[model samples]
Target: MHLNRRHFLGTGIAASALLTAPTVWGQAKPKVVVIGGGAGGATAARYLAKDSGGAIEVTLVEANPVYTTCFFSNLYLGGFRDFESLQHNYDKLAGGGVTVINDMATGVDRAAKTVTLAGGQVLPYDRLVLSPGIDFKDGSVPGWSLDAAEKMPHAYKAGPQTQLLKKMVEEMPEGGVFAMIAPPNPYRCPPGPYERISMIAHVLKQKNPTAKIIVADPKEKFSKQALFEEGWNKHYAGMVEWIGPDFGGGKVEVRPDAMEVVIDGEVTKVDCCNVIPGQMAGKIAALAGVTDDSGWAPVDPATMKAKADENVWVLGDSSAQGDMPKSGFSANSQAKVAAMTIRGELTGSKTFPAKYSNTCWSLIAPDDGVKVGASYEPTPEKIASVESFISETGEDAALRKATYEESLGWYAGITADMFG
Candidate 1:
């Protein structure tokens, strides 16, 4: 389990890789360990190494070698994209001088400032960035547990579960019922469930037009609600049904064994069920003692540094910073600020005022996209929204198509920025 000098340097990279930390220089380098390789962690790792120009040793710890992006998994379900198009590997990060380790972080010793991997390798770090994404809150939904995921797939983390959900949708019997148990607010990707509904409807429209999709939501309103409703009526009229909290959307339970969903004490048989439970910061954040009582990690709005631990920074869906939603764009924006602050503290790199931005784009159907976004700055109390914009309902098809294309460009640019 010991990572000898040679093995540590040569295992995931070339013998002459810059990830070796300039051992010949006879000076200790500040080691930065980033746990999680999603939008936030990967970008933080890449920026830390690139902006530092090899002055610091950066190690990225990820549980998966290839990431399946949850942001656009809906598109894959709609058949607009393939699974391969959604996957990005870590070889580019490894080649770019980051010590990319495909390992799960099991524990964090704060006083010792060391991270323990599931394989028993311990990594010492001057600073740690934790962006492990979201995990379902225990018992958030009655009769649903992680053990029940295979039967009623959440598909919230992407990858295999996404494929499972898609397959379930595609294999639905003619005129079968598809049901979704939407999560509450303050969860990752505010517009994700609705977009998912649109994609599933798109699939059913083509494969089984008589099939029906149902959404039992706890919230009275959702992101882009007006736009989504308009699109649903225009594109998939009478095929999709949304029951809000006023109609007892909040009271729901599922019996995965019988493939039944209970809304407001009324049981209905469903051919497929996607039970998205409440969420919290990833397990590693709690393991590291960074999360607060709210089941999320609180961070300084200015620098994304963990309020509980100065040596730690939490990003993405794991962070409960004020005002910013837990989207990939928000995480990427926060990571840049945190990366700059870390560089400034360790390498004396000049730091600027922390400003962040995020834009979440969703596809209603093929060539129809809508978006919501805002610019923000760190205030004394929270990260406050500055200026905001959203796509209005009834926009021209050309504009919607343009918005979808814009999102495609962002995906390409952000992935390149994160991976390389």
Candidate 2:
């Protein structure tokens, strides 16, 4: 059942009619419009469509026809994983009676409760869920823009850019410098940049021993700092160099074709560069007038309901959930809680206060992994941590290998839960 534009709209109308039936009086099927189809949005769509049992209408809008995860993308660059393994289809959501629209969302009319797409179609919704993810804070690097990203790939989003970076690395000359400009704190995947450097270093050691990897970071410390430093020392001594903010090697200013990173008032050029700029909520969140000065939507921790508008719910990277990191796992977990809250609110049932969980994994090498996780609950002043699941610095080689394997298993299970 290929749901073209016409069929999708028709199904939505039909679902609306069923809710208005006399026999089902007082029972209104809440119309849910999800603005992104990545981990968070896809999980929410599947759960709402399946759990509602036709009692709720689920419509998902995504710009891309398929999704490629940022997780494990470093392995792709290291030539350890294939691109196809990271791709996911939306068949499960469609089969479960979800109205999937493969189109970019242009705006969201919160007052009118309608979403405007790039094609000029408006989707009316009784309740809106936005998980559009993050967008780079352009100009954080003086001359860095979308155009410049083509030449100097950030590879942060894990798609075409990842391929471009891999190709560049493969073609670079021996003894060439592969520079990576790391972003500051409070960004997606806190440990991602370090993990990328580790993977790239692994390749450099194997393929081009003369090649050098440099990380120019704005922060003094990072995720799994001690672990990553220990691995670098034990494995690739003197092959990788990290310049912290104090070393004057981390400030970045973008040029038209290159990035100018100032370190101690001196500049060093590179053969290829990966500059990960700062990030904020996606465009759709801004369109809905839910974002504030921080460029992220604020939501009530207890309900995941937008503080700007009651009918709207924001989760994932786009929403400012107190103290929660912008991670896929956190987003997926929050979506489940959001779904339950929405269902209870519409059905006049008891609503439970929302709780969120997050676990982030970073691989130091092909068979070495480290993780940090926490669970949170709402408090009178803010959301507070309830428990921690932090992995220790030292572990047996077999344990690290098992963790790496488990990470892959987790990816498969989460992807299946979202898109089947």
Highest TM-score scorer: 1
Deviation in Å, model 1, residue 68 alpha carbon: 1.0
Q: By summed lDDT, which 10 consecutive residues of candidate 2 come out lowest? A: 20-29
TM-score, candidate 2, is: 0.92
State the displacement of the C-alpha of residue 68, model 2, in Å, after optimal TM-score superposition.
0.9
Instruction: Name every residue pair that clashes in candidate 2.
Output: 248-263
- Tens digits of per-residue lDDT, candidate 2, 150-249, equal 7788898989999999988887789888888788767888888888888888888888889988887888899878889877886688988999988755
Q: Tell me how many clashing residue pairs each candidate has.
A: 0, 1
All models: lDDT?
A: 0.92, 0.82
Residue pair clashes in candidate 1: none
Q: What digit string (tens of lDDT, one per residue) describes model 1 on residues 1-420?
A: 445743663443553355566555433578899999999999999999989999889999999989988888889989999999999999888887899999999999999888999988999899999999999998888999989999999999999999999999999999999999999988999999999999999999999999999999999899999989999998999999999999989999999999999999999999999999999999999999999899999999999999999999999999989999999999999999989999999999999999899999999998999999999999989999999999998899999999999999988988888887
lDDT of 2 at 79: 76
